[model samples]
Target: MSYEGSFRVWRGDDDAGGLVDYQVEVNDGEVVLDVIHRLQATQAPDLAVRWNCKAGKCGSCSAEVNGRPRLLCMTRMSTFSPDEVVTVTPLRTFPVLRDLVTDVSFNYEKAREIPAFEPPKGVAPGDYRMAQVDVGRSQEFRKCIECFLCQDVCHVIRDHEQNKPAFAGPRFFIRIAELDMHPLDTREGRAEAAQDEHGLGLCNITKCCTEVCPEGIKITDNGIIPMKERVVDRKYDPLVWLGSKIFRRQT
Candidate 1:
């Protein structure tokens, strides 16, 4: 069935902005992004929406639909009644560049702060080996498309901008977790990075980030919790502390 509806899309740049309603016709199996493109073609020629692969794989086209973080390309128009108006707004966590476009530079800066992987030295390029079970742990986190939806929904950095400086959000926590779990990684700073002010401690584990993840990454359970466990082990485990000391003496 075909239905005509009005979409109230937030439109503007840094100086000023407001919601501009546009009328569009929707067909069965149509997604919100489909209707948005119609508006761009007919009503607003300059309407800016960032998107790469319309197919849900790109992780782009993220926005807030009726106040919830979601990927426009994945949200079906069928979910809402034709009589009801759908509101599309840019992600609330980042600075607005224009209609449906937000500056996500903050994420890049935080990423730069994370220390890169430092594998054990003297191992030949193909000599490093790891058990399948150990390698499997990080595979889930590797699914992230860098959509930043997890970053946008996270309250530690979303609602509390003040905490941005000290919080790495869920995305980078996954990175840190992946690196920390790597069998070949000789880096000893995982515990320190996780304990830092801008680390895992800031996360209240609200799970909002996980809900909006396009790749269905288990951000809170599989990633954040394991990293937290590592931090706890390093800071409080007497056995590990004593073992490390003895191992150091023997070396």
Candidate 2:
């Protein structure tokens, strides 16, 4: 069975825009993206939306639904009643290019800031080995689909545009965290990078990023918090500092 659903889709470019309401037919087992597709086909022929692999893997359909960061393709229409008015808007953290499509180049800039993974010097590609426990930690973080939903919800950059210069947000924290935790990655100074350079201190553990993650990655608790603790331990704890100094002197 299908019914009419009202959608308040923000329509315009970076300069200005507002919610343009559209009444569309909702179908069984359809998602928010489906409603948007209907809108493109019927009411608003000029409506522009970016989506791929409508199965929710591509993370291209990132948007704010009812004021929450979500993947439009993953959000089931059945979650809302037939009469409930759904609101879909471009990610507020970034400039909108057109209707429902935001210029997410900020995330690309942040991605470039993260240093690439560095394997141990002696470990060639064929000889690389990792314990199951270490592999487990990095594996969890590698699941991120680059949705930027985490980046969009992070208040450090969300509310304060100035923070963009410093903050890489939760998504890249996952990237850094994975590299830092990887057994094969012998690179040092990631803890410092996460704290001093990437604005880890700006995160007050709101867990907003974790809540919106489609991958169910424990971004705040597992990645950000652990990285924060590691940073603090390396920076403030006398034992780790002394150990590092002793190791350096011996070498």
Candidate 3:
């Protein structure tokens, strides 16, 4: 069965915008993206929304549904009552390019700031090997689709625009955690970079990034917290500090 749904969609560009109400037809098993598509087809031909592979893996459809970051294609319409005025808005953390689409280039800049995976010097591409446990650990982080919902929800950049320059946010934190955990990776001082450079200290363990993840990746527990612990241990532990000094001297 289908019903008429009330949707309040934000429309306009960076300089001006407001939520424009629309009464649209909602169908069974349909998602918010579908309704937005309906709006594009019926009423608002100029409505701007970014989406691809509506199956939820592409992460292109990132937006705020009633102020919560979410992939519009994955948010089922059934979650809301028929009469509820579902509000769809652009991700607030980023600048609005237009209706329901924000300039997410901030995430790309953060991605570029992260160092790439460096394999051991002697290990050839085919010869590199890792234990099952290590492979499993890395695989979990590889599941990130780069949705930026985590970044959008992160308060460091969300609330304080000034913090954007210093903070790489949770998405890159997990990336650093992944590389730091790599058994064959030769890069050193990753934890230091995370803390001193990427603004890891600003996190405060809020876990807001983990809450909105569509993939259910334990971003806070599995990635950020462990990295924080490593940072603490490396900075404060006497033995680790001594070992680092000795290693540097020997090298």
Candidate 2 residue 213 C-alpha distance from true site, Å: 0.3
RMSD of 3: 2.2
- How accurate locally, in lDDT, is each candidate? 0.86, 0.90, 0.92
Worst 10 residues of 3 by lDDT: 242-251
Order of models, best lDDT first: 3, 2, 1
In order of listing, the candidates' clash counts read 1, 0, 0
Off by over 4 Å in 2: 246-251
- Residue 102 deviation, candidate 3, in Å? 0.8
Candidate 3 lDDT over residue span 1-251, tens digit each:
89999999999999998999999999999999999999999999999999999998999999999878999999999999998999999999999999988999999998999999999898889998888886677678899999899999998999999999999999999999999988888998999999999999999888998999898989999999999988986786888778877786421
| Poorly placed runs, candidate 1 (over 4 Å) | 124-127, 243-251
* Local error of candidate 1 at residue 199 (angstroms): 2.4
Across 1-251, the per-residue lDDT of candidate 1 in tens digits comes to 99898789999988999998878989999999999998889888899999988888888899999988889999999899999999999999999999999999999998898888786788877887888888787888888889898999888777788988888889999988888887777787776777774568877788887888889889889889888877776777788768878786321
Clash count for candidate 2 is 0
Once model 2 is optimally superposed onto the true structure by TM-score, how far is the C-alpha of residue 158 displaced, in angstroms?
A: 0.6
Residue pairs in collision within model 2: none
TM-score of each: 0.93, 0.95, 0.95
